[model samples]
Target: MDFHVLELFSGIGGMHYAFRSAAVPGKVIAAMDINTNANAVYAHNFPTTSVCNNNIQSLTPEKIEKLNVNMILMSPPCQPHTRVGNRLDVDDNRSDGLQHICNLLPLCQGVQYILMENVKGFEISKAHDQFLDALRLAGYQWREFILCPTQFGIPNSRRRYYCLARKKEFCFDGGHILDDIPIEFRMGVIDGMMISNLLLPDNLIGPECYLPDKILSKRVWLMDIVTAEARKTMCFTKAYTYYSEGTGSIYCPLNKKEMDIVFAKVKELELSEESEALRLELLKSLKLRYFTPREIARLMSFPNTFEFPTETTNRQKYRFLGNSINVHVVGVLIKILCS
Candidate 1:
């Protein structure tokens, strides 16, 4: 059966792409977001779909009902639930969008399926409670998951919270947290997944990706460095490239022995200007660099057909990608949810 979908908080159409990747027959009636750059990217890629630049809170039950959509896919603002944030949740002004959606649920009776993605901490929030209450009041049965892309045989470690709800009978009996990726939903080879498989040809990795000497000398210790052969990477945030520690992993194009030598010298260095200079030089030898946006997109399981418009800046690319979902993982979830 074909589904009419309304995507809220759509960033570069990740949910739309994932929906298509699921091989589910669907039409995205409207893709909505406030970010102009993201909307531009979505429009560029999905010329046939309507991309709306509007705040989620402004979406009324009347407006949504007019679309006659059965499925609602959303990735709401996660800042309020992030560990680093104040954890204001429903109290945070940023959460107004999701809270508004909850208010609309009861009035929009035609909506049968809802899928949402957010940071891992969301399940515990007051916003989550409100959402659950709304779903229950609307006679929807839901399942929640705390999944990572690694579970889907992707090398990246983006542990996130997902909720799949439907108005139909809950055929798949389960508790709130899905502990495993059901065999039916599994894709890719778990044993063979590596960062190397997602990397671009060396020629495409430009010198522009190189880290500055200042960051190398001061922030090297905090960087989560990984080689191409490695199977995992830290979760990349929008702050990637702008921040070093905890922002994301850096690419290290050096062998184990070379990395060992460089780190050993770094450990021995005193807190002096001379030591900082030596640290910079040592790190420079490693040729450490940020993963280009394209590499991150690949790691996120975006298809090769995905492309940023020529006018989109590198920073914009990283920001949109960081905000987006892992298409492959979400695709599997969509198949399970829609089935």
Candidate 2:
């Protein structure tokens, strides 16, 4: 049950949180990421752990050897392989870190299990091919999953690609190395919790742990989204607050009649025909505020005690939450492989 974890590109130590929060007995020996902001948050939450803010390409075998961890968990940068990105694949500079990790796979004597999470497009990317090739060459068997939080009953719909690889010595039953082998084969059903179930009662939730009420006071459409009977929404990205187009889900609890009435008002006010600012004001008036950092963190399955530094801004917090992994979902995956 002893799991020594090495976290690569460890944004906010999401994997580290999963490793510890799950039933598995493990500790992250070291976590590496180049983003100082994320490292700060990771350090804030896990003060005792070693968090190295450095490029992955600089992660030498000697460094891996020193940590001497038995498992690797990472969610490498997905920009290069993302649909909106340049789709540079393995040619992208960001991929260098993962490539470096791949190179170290054969050299790192203690690494036995690997769990990599990335955007859905990653499965088809050349970078994925390179990663799989490395694992195969290193004699590790892997299973691929295109999983979403909704599958486990959490409302946020973040469909990601996960590759769970185990050294041959600890391999699964020679299963399809590129398919979503049922985790249920080993781990039982993960208890389902609706988004409403996760939220603390309004009276109990701190008044200040949310966006300012005045900004979204008029936006009636921007109400509780994770309510009972309706428990789902879209993926959250770093652009969550900065760009609302496809960022993440909102808390809108509007009913069909109410939605029609709101749209009718938009048409009546001709807000769509006005300046962008005016249209935004109209939208904001619908009570559509960004999910408070704490709410988003809760949706992402970060525990109540997980907090940002006092100086961290809401925008920065949103970015961090959007980038961090869903602890509950990832915890299930780890339990499946480790338990």
List per-prediction Cα lDDT, in the order shown: 0.88, 0.74
TM-scores, all models, native as reference: 0.95, 0.84
lDDT of 1 at 20: 92
Steric overlap count per candidate: 0, 8
Give the top-scoring candidate (TM-score): 1
Give lDDT tens digits, candidate 1, residues 1-339.
789999999989999999998888978999999999999999999999999999998888889889989999999999999767789898889999998999999999989999999999999999999999999998899989999988767889999999999988655666768856666656634567888888888888888899988888778888999997888998888989998899889998886677888888766665434556676677788889999999999989888889899999999998999889999888888888898
Model 1, 154: alpha-carbon shift in Å?
0.7
Best by lDDT: 1
lDDT of 2: 0.74
User: After superposition, which runs of candidate 1 have C-alpha atoms over 4 Å from their true positions?
Assistant: 187-191, 268-276
Cα deviation in Å at residue 130, candidate 2?
0.6
Writing each residue's lDDT as its tens digit, candidate 2 over 1-339 gives: 588998989988789888876768778888999999889989999999999988888887787888878999999988888766789888888888888888888887688899999988888888888898899888887777887877766778888888888865444554443444464453433456665565545565544443344434343344433333356766888887665457775553345466556657666666446654554465544443346677778777788888888888877988788778888778878876674
Worst 10 residues of 1 by lDDT: 268-277
